[model samples]
Target: MRPPNTPPARAVSTPAADDTPAADDTEFRTLLDRLSDKATADYYNPFTTFDWPASIPTDELWMSPELLSCHGTELMDELSPAQLRTLSRWESVNFYSLNVHGIRELLIEVTRRVHTPGFELPSEFFHHFIGEENDHMWFFATFCLKYAGKIYPDRSVKLPEAPRDPDIENFLVFARILIFEQIVDHYNVQMAADRRLHPTVRHINRLHHQDESRHIAFGCRLVRLLWERLLDRGPDEAARHELRGHLGGYLGRYLTTSIESLYNPAVYRDAGLPDGFALRKRLLVHPARQAAHAKVLHKTTGFLQRIGVFDARH
Candidate 1:
């Protein structure tokens, strides 16, 4: 087990290179083009991908307690044996609910890119992105709707606008989107390996996980190139600081989004936890969950710091 308080493994910083990345940029674009070509032919329509006629088993647990965010006082050593099982079930549903909501928003953003001027190339990847996220949203909703009879709506987690300049909005959006995708990708990978999950849940996760590997690859390459491209253009120090601040807040939100508002903590109140809000606080700060939080956030954080977006001394 990872020791408590030991910082999670994260990438260290490197000085920003001050040269043009024309060759590297071309190489990255070529790779994305190849992925677009492959996706154009190989993409599966989400509508036909799954057999939705099967009934979801309501009693089946979708998440393990170990996977739940650590902030709940009723978790781990604090829970009664019976409550532990319920906690596991709640966490699973909570996880799926967040996916349903987040994917919906991301799909909205991606769909806007399709067939638009200046985004024609990215529109190819968006086709694949929409296809994958639509399937993801469907199965997650299918489980919730079939078993629970409703899908949860988005929680209130609106982030403050990051520094705005026409010059930096493109870079900022690239960073923001990448940060969100990386966190989701972490959960997808982890859940795919969890044997306690029901078969249908596992099948959905495995398929989503398989597709996200490519999305992450594309996002990572694009974000890196975008950052490099921006840095080469030489923003002022104030702009750099604003970008870092935005990234930090975005990172924190990405890490804590599910823990903060995804579940009706009131469910815990019904489950014999003192009150729902207290349970929310407990889980939000739990060491194990926090570690998992850091694990996901690190993908984007580490990349940013290494690429000179979040310098330590600043």
Candidate 2:
């Protein structure tokens, strides 16, 4: 049975050729073909890719210090060096856990649309995307389970019901995927380059970053294409304004939710911090943390604004 409050699934329609977006434009087709080739050339066996150490040292940093939720806050001064290290360990696990959960959600959404009428042109690249993401989920989950002995439960709030309009739904899905990847790639790029982290930690981040580059490239182009299609529908000025406001609002909330998930209470409890809930609440709104969130999302928001998915003032 469909879950309560879930939006009813829309039937996939084979819209008439003229009704659909020109997704087969020469530029888009070239991008898909190039990315598909890159995916083929870059394929690797995840199971054998890394030398998983029997254990990572608890005293060492598992995650980069600056990426921690409490970084740059007064709370940083309150925690001892040992406490900071412990926090980093659990936070690293939490980060990977988020990746596993996020990748799973995107995979399901993409799988639903692949080979469907409006998506026919990009279905080939979808195969590559799906395979690569499945591999990512595996490695991330493996890292968490093998080292931490547990993957943190996904703490994200359930998203609101999706709009019944298929074009809107499709645009939102790809936009969400792009935003998620861009946020994750920010972390991946940082950790992969931080030499203080363990080699295994660095290796996984580096590998994920490599594949994510291709995925992000594809996502940016496809999201822009989808947005263009929506605009081409020629709604009245008021309707067009409403559509833009709705999309901007939804994506803004999504970005906030994604950032908040990084501050899991369970991570705090495991790290030996008292009042995990209160700490989460306070840290979420802290001036420094707010700035950090903006930095993390800078690239994503810039892209969205450039594509007109977001207003310049937003």
lDDT of 1: 0.61
Q: How well is each residue in 1-314 modelled by candidate 1, as lDDT tens digits?
A: 00011111111112237734447655765877877776666567666776765664545556655555544333567765566666656656666777777777666655654665545446667777788778877888887777666655555466555444543454555555666666666767767787876776677777777777778788777667666656655578787666667655554454455335534575565456677886677667667656666665676667777877765532
Compute the lDDT of residue 228 as modeled in candidate 2: 78
Candidate 2 residue-wise lDDT, 1-314, digit = tens: 00112222232234456764443466787898999999999999998887888998998999999999999999999999999999999999999999998888888888887877667778899999999899999999999999999999866876676677878888888888998999999999999999999999999999999999999999998888788778868567777788888888888888988899999999999999999999999999999999999999999999999988799876
RMSD of 1: 7.7
The candidate scoring highest on lDDT is 2
Any idea what lDDT model 2 has?
0.86
